[model samples]
Target: MSDKKRRQRLVQWPRVALTTGGVVLAAAATTFVVRTGDAASITADSGATPTRTVVAIPGPRTSTPPPAPVTVTVPGLPVETPVRVTPPGAAAAPLAQVQVNSAEIVYTVAGNQRPDDPVTITYADEAGALRTVENVSLPWRLTVIPTVPVNYVTASSNGSQLNCWITDAHGATVAASTDNTISATCNR
Candidate 1:
């Protein structure tokens, strides 16, 4: 064949393929519309009247709008300043002049016990908290400041004749206990 005839045949093949592809796509789209209940159909017979069919067209699609952005604000704290006031007739007192009624508590444990005998000392500290000293030798002494109303000292020993004493800040014995076998307690 001639070159010009061969070229014309090649161009005609492309046109034919494009037309077939367009027809197939149109048919597929129509089938999808019928299957999804989006198409209208009508029927008629050779000797009967044509029938009109109505299809419910859907409304415009709508979606809920997204919520607005939220913002929160916190107020800043107010500034505070210390204030001092004096009595109408009395002068202002300095902070150092303020006195606290603190007392010294002396816990002493002594007896005719042997030097090798160990003892246990239990007492309340200034803040009314119990403290324990385990395996302590005889002639045990502990001094503390008493801030609570009640203070106590207890001693336990396996030695013979254990005596305990609790002295106040005035060098006076407030509580004393003596035990010949195991334990001695002093409370004030």
Candidate 2:
């Protein structure tokens, strides 16, 4: 070929590139339009899932108070006169169980040998296991306080069976008088 023909071909190179780019852009735009139109038709047709948006609005915030004693008395009840109903030998019997905090066992000397006197009742943790051990550090004869986490206890040192009254962290009796001696189940 001659130099003049070669130069003419080189000068038209930019035009060729522009034409190719324009065709590609046009094809892309046509494809987008076809897709959009098909979308509308599909929505109008049967068995097409509609555009659904899930809206979640949060619930109202309210401040709740910690659990404490609340005494509620109803109106119009029969007023009764004070009557002594002490049994023949009930008050004379020592306190079988008493509520306490944390995890510890203390005795108030029914005797130095008694496992539980003025029995301390507490749960193992928030997990609801009864404290049942005789934790006397130095054989306490009188007023004894032992700081040990005891499990559920059943029998006394005097070869007699004792009642188990397990209480929760709130000082409320959770389990009173279990049928079994080994385990104590607290109420929910």
Top model number, lDDT: 1
Residue runs of model 1 more than 4 Å from their true location after superposition: 1-102
lDDT of 2 by residue, 1-188 (tens): 99999999999999999999999999999999999988867765644443333222211111322232233332233333333332111223446765444443322112123344333333343233454545432122111122434323233433222334433333334334434333223322
The global C-alpha lDDT for each of the candidates, from Candidate 1 onward, is 0.63, 0.39
Model 2 Cα shift for residue 29 (angstroms): 0.9
Roughly what TM-score does model 1 have, to 2 decimal places? 0.43
Query: Best TM-score goes to which candidate?
Result: 1
Q: Which stretches of candidate 2 lie over 4 Å from their true place?
A: 46-188
Worst 10 residues of 1 by lDDT: 53-62
Lowest summed lDDT across 10 adjacent residues in model 2 is found at 57-66
**TM-scores, in order shown?**
0.43, 0.23
